[model samples]
Target: MNDYSKAARAADRVRIVELDAEIQELQARIRLLQLERYPCQQRLDAHRYPVLALPNEIVGEIFVHFLPLYPDTPPLTGIYSPTTLTHICSQWREIALATPKLW
Candidate 1:
């Protein structure tokens, strides 16, 4: 009976160790995915961002798409939604601000 109990505990310990190792592996994979995604995000941001000569209407359209839909307005503070729009640069801030529908 003692030996059987010891074996069961040992098995449980091994299973716990295996689960821990798998969690570590998953964490590493998540980190790897984030590293892989950062460049992709930058590329996407570049493509999405208007650094140069696109028309203001087009830029306004883009800003309009970034505003949040359902939240109650954030007061006259002039911040709008979809999060990433206002969180970006000065030019982006202006574009988001000027789009009449954004607020």
Candidate 2:
């Protein structure tokens, strides 16, 4: 090719390399942003479920209220059973187990 065409091709190749480097930098930044977002996103989602914020004592009290009245026993395993409380989540499971009245 002519000298002008050779210079133009060389310039194009250099621009291409620069653009590829920029793309790689942007991709790395995106990955970092995603990593930072994960915990914040989890916190935001946790906030959406306000019940999880209740104190353990209050949760235990709620479980007591969930039980049948005095002298009545809840089933071993069912929707209305205290075991159902244990099945809900780790926090509730702890609360239910700690509250002697539920047993």
Candidate 3:
């Protein structure tokens, strides 16, 4: 029937219009998310950078472990010995004193 065919065509047109609107909204949301992530993407694009962050106390401990000390040495030599941990930088010396294991 002519009426039936007309109704079918109208229904088809309405479905197609709704599908187009849904596709357009999906594209808009994708564009918005891309803009939101643009800065983070730029940061990720940069090269890696190296850093030095070992604490002075850690350095002093390491040097103390490597030092040569004689337990039987006189107290005077213990105070003036080059092998003493404090002969290094003042900061390292202070750390070594606080961490007596360095002696």
By TM-score, the best candidate is 2
List where candidate 3 sits over 4 angstroms from the true fold: 1-4, 47-103
- In model 2, which regions exceed 4 Å deviation? 1-31
Per-residue lDDT over 17-50 for candidate 2, one digit per residue giving the tens place of the 0 to 100 score = 9999999999999999999999998899789877
Model 1 lDDT per residue over 6-102, tens place: 7799999999999999999999999999999999988888787746357767887876665555455534444554345656777767776777777
Q: How far is 21's C-alpha from truth in model 2 (Å)?
A: 11
All candidates in order of TM-score, best leading: 2, 1, 3
| lDDT of model number 3 | 0.63
- Using lDDT as the yardstick, the better of models 1 and 2 is 2
lDDT of 3 by residue, 7-101 (tens): 79999999999999999999999999999999876666443211113576666566555555656332324644434656755655666667655
lDDT-wise, the better of 1 and 3 is 1
TM-score per prediction, in order, is 0.47, 0.62, 0.40
Cα-based lDDT at residue 59, candidate 1: 80
Point to the candidate with the largest lDDT: 2
